[model samples]
Target: MEFRRLIRGRVDEPQLERIGREIAKRYDRESVRISVLEADNWLSTPCVVDEEWFVKVISPQNALVQALFTGARNLGVFSRGEEGFFERFEDPLAMSQHELEATRRVREIGLNAPEPIEAFGVDEFGVLVLEYLPEFRTLDELPSTEVEALASELFSALTLMHANNLAHGDLRGENVLVHGGELYFIDATNVRKDGLSTARAYDIACAIATLEPALGANCTVDLAAEHYDAATLLAARDFLDLVRLRPDHEFEATRLKGEIERRAD
Candidate 1:
């Protein structure tokens, strides 16, 4: 059970093409008309295609593919590979394998992620086809309540992963997407099966630190403290304070604290 095989079950190019064609038909889009939007430039940027889908390509034989598989599952992203594109990359086989595994795992967890449509390792390049989320905004731009709700959902998701011995290596506001008023976890490439407790705590801390500033007055320190551990609450408060001190930061800490205390009374 290699990681790649674990994530992506054995499937050849002809099968992948069939799958892709099926997906295209289902979506009422032409597979041949879909063009390549971008390629990896070592930035790990999520490639956007036709304003309708995102794509991630990989070489079939890469070891990192297994890791990606686990990540995609944890984050709930969809993934598949393209046939006859293996020769397009420096090591198409390895990359294809890695991306396929990642995509497969992401699709497994029932998260709102891109859907994989095809996968195949060939001489030109190993590539993945994924569904794209549209009208999505980053968490940073979302409303405070929406952000907090997303944080709650993300924490709950992490809790479930921790219970099953999984951890999202990188959990941050930037890694979350808000589409149609819902949160979607993206970028699970660094996910692993170790340090579940620590990773869960760290992710909680990251969410608290990241979202505290945008929280409304109704979202008080005490309310947050009620939901999180003492240490995490404190860290969140400290982070909030640091941001408050910055002239450019829009939040008013003194007013928020007073509002919280008033509500407590």
Candidate 2:
């Protein structure tokens, strides 16, 4: 946790105040209330603005960390003899803009995504604003039974994403938020436009790893198969071991592999 904090860096109080002032200016408010969110975000400082806007204050360091992560993920894909798929931004503002566009695209495809507001640079930090969902629980915070009930919709949403030439790239518990009893995706990592197929499969693998702990291997595979065929699911097999290596994902890779094969047969 401490290491993560160091890598995420910090937005000092003065910078926070400046960002708040910018929000106030944008909304034509005399002042806006700002409160930092407790998140294990690797790329940006997330906060709520005036209780109405969800904001991310991204710094140069955050952009560097994002690039580093992208490089590492690409290397993982390369290890499996496939070209890397993840994309990286040049700087903080670009990172903010990319997320803004990605979130908007997700919403366009009939999925629940926060309404993207805008992206602007304040000093060296890039600020991203979006509509805030007042009450929400991350997928990880939900119980196993609740996760099971939501499994179909979750995979359904993922299918919608891939069918439309979109891929979440990063789909873990924290990125999947439950609000108003529906699944909303956030913090999508950028992937190569030409690599959507690989990205789609990788996303499926990540999704499987994410739900396996809660729904168990068989139930998770069954739910996934509702939208993906045996071949499509099999495409994700190469990324399973890679996804499992992520600390956020800890599932039975061997068990999932067996279930996926059984479904194929």
Top lDDT prediction, candidate number: 2
Per-residue lDDT of candidate 1, residues 96-115 (tens digit) = 45455544565576565556
The parts of candidate 1 lying over 4 Å away from their true place are 1-42, 57-103, 118-127, 189-192, 216-227, 231-265
List clash counts for every candidate, in order: 39, 0
What does the lDDT come to for candidate 1? Answer: 0.49
Model 2 pairs whose backbones collide: none
lDDT of 2 by residue, 1-265 (tens): 8887899898999999998998898779999889999888888999998789999999999999889888999999888778788888898999899999989889988999889999999998999999999899999899999998888888888778877877898899999989989999998654666788889889999999999988899999998988889999998977898898766677999999999999999
lDDT for 250 in candidate 2 is 78
TM-score for all models, in order of appearance: 0.51, 0.95
* TM-score for predicted model 1 compared with the true structure: 0.51
